[model samples]
Target: MKHLTRLATAALMTTSLATFAQAGGHANWTSVADQSSIAFGSIKKDTVGEVHHFEDVIGTVSEAGELAVSIQLGSVETYIDIRNERMIEHVFRAADAKATLAGEVDMEELDALGVGETTLTDFEGVLSLGGLEADIEAELLVARLSEDRVLVTTANMIMLSTADLGIDAGIDTLMKLAKLPGITRVTPVTVRMVFEK
Candidate 1:
């Protein structure tokens, strides 16, 4: 009976190891950069709004469920080359800016997501840009596209203030360069990210 008990214990240990490995593997994810986008809307004159997007946004999810995204400041696209250049030089100071965002999510919550199901969750993180960091709180829509793929997107617009990031002076410079009477200090941003195992 003691021998049988030892054999059962050994089998249980093997099963536990396999389960842990599978769980670890599932938590590691790589971003599909070509399929992801980060877009923002800026208002000029407190009325005219224009939508712009970044061409180079990359992200990754670690096995421990930490998510980090790096956005190329110089990749800002405003549908016009001249405007894009202006934004990079004046507003973002692309040459010296480090734009990164990071956050953590419960891996267990993600692991419980079933294929074809969507879950709404709160994502809390920090957005670091132009030598300043601000706490970020946004709603996220997480969809399990497949066993090896997942999609995460902003469920609502996140508003950011230029003053909060010490970029208000840059906005003033842009306003002057463009001869605009006024430019709103707040911008709305969103992200659509796709990750695969």
Candidate 2:
């Protein structure tokens, strides 16, 4: 009888520990870089469009449902190294500024998501770049990949204006450097992100 009581106590302790660990795990999530991407489209001369991507991006989601993404400005890739350098030096000023986007969601809404379920929702956030910040809205497709993972993607392109972010001077510089007739002030950006607990 004494052996049976000890066994029961040990089993209960193990179960309690497991529950605590799982609870703690749900409070924080890290972005999976291998499965994520951030890209944008730029139009020049009113007809020439090019797609560019950032090669180094990172994100994190807190238990409170705050989402933050950091993009390395120097990681901008335009398929041409010279163009990349030009963008860094003139447009983004990567040497002096860091680009980041951040927002918060209702944690209860996320917690209520069932396994394998997906939802399309609106997310409002702030985009900061080149020493400027602007309020932005994005349509998001969020999916619960598993109990410990979630996938979030933009449903439509996010339109950003150089004028809005106070980057018009940078745009002018870029146009002059490229010897282009005109570069559109608006850019379209999209992102795919995966977070794991």
Candidate 3:
């Protein structure tokens, strides 16, 4: 009976390891640079709004339900050369800077998605920007685009306060420098991320 119990224990351990490996393998995917994008919008003078693009962003979904994204703060394209320079100096405050976001996902749920299937789910993540971190919540639409590719997009816009991100001082500077009457303190952000195995 002791020997039989030992054999049963070994079998259970093996089964658990296999289940873990399969979940990790199914969740592992890397961001496709040319196909993935993250964007945010700003409002200045209370009425003029513009969308800004992050040209260099990369992310990955890892084993055991971890997702991470990093963006080069200097890669922001504001459609104006001097404005870009000003933003880098004033808002971002560093020549070499990076903003990172990390989120947790359900490994089993992600693995269960089949090709061409889509689902809307609640997402919560930490956004680290301008030397501070803030909790962000959003509704995400996750779609399995192909056997090797998955697409995730924001179903609802994420609104963030500059004060919470420690970037308000810089935006204040920009408003004064640009002689703008006012700029909105809250910004709306959205993302379209594509990942491949």
Enumerate clash totals for all models, in the order shown: 0, 0, 0
CA lDDT, every prediction?
0.59, 0.60, 0.61
What residue runs in model 3 are displaced by over 4 Å at the alpha carbon? 1-27
Residue 145 C-alpha lDDT in model 2: 75
TM-score of 2: 0.83
TM-score of every candidate: 0.83, 0.83, 0.84
Among these predictions, the greatest lDDT belongs to: 3
Consecutive 10-residue window with the lowest summed lDDT within model 1:
1-10
Instruction: Please give the distance, in angstroms, between residue 26's alpha carbon in candidate 1 and its true position after superposition.
Output: 3.4
Q: Which stretches of candidate 1 lie over 4 Å from their true place?
A: 1-27
Clashes of 2: 0
As for TM-score, the candidate ahead, 1 or 2, is: 1
Residue clash pairs of candidate 2: none
* Candidate 3 total steric clashes: 0
Give a tens-digit lDDT track for model 1, residues 96-129. 3446767666656555767788777766666666
Q: TM-score: which is higher, 2 or 3?
A: 3
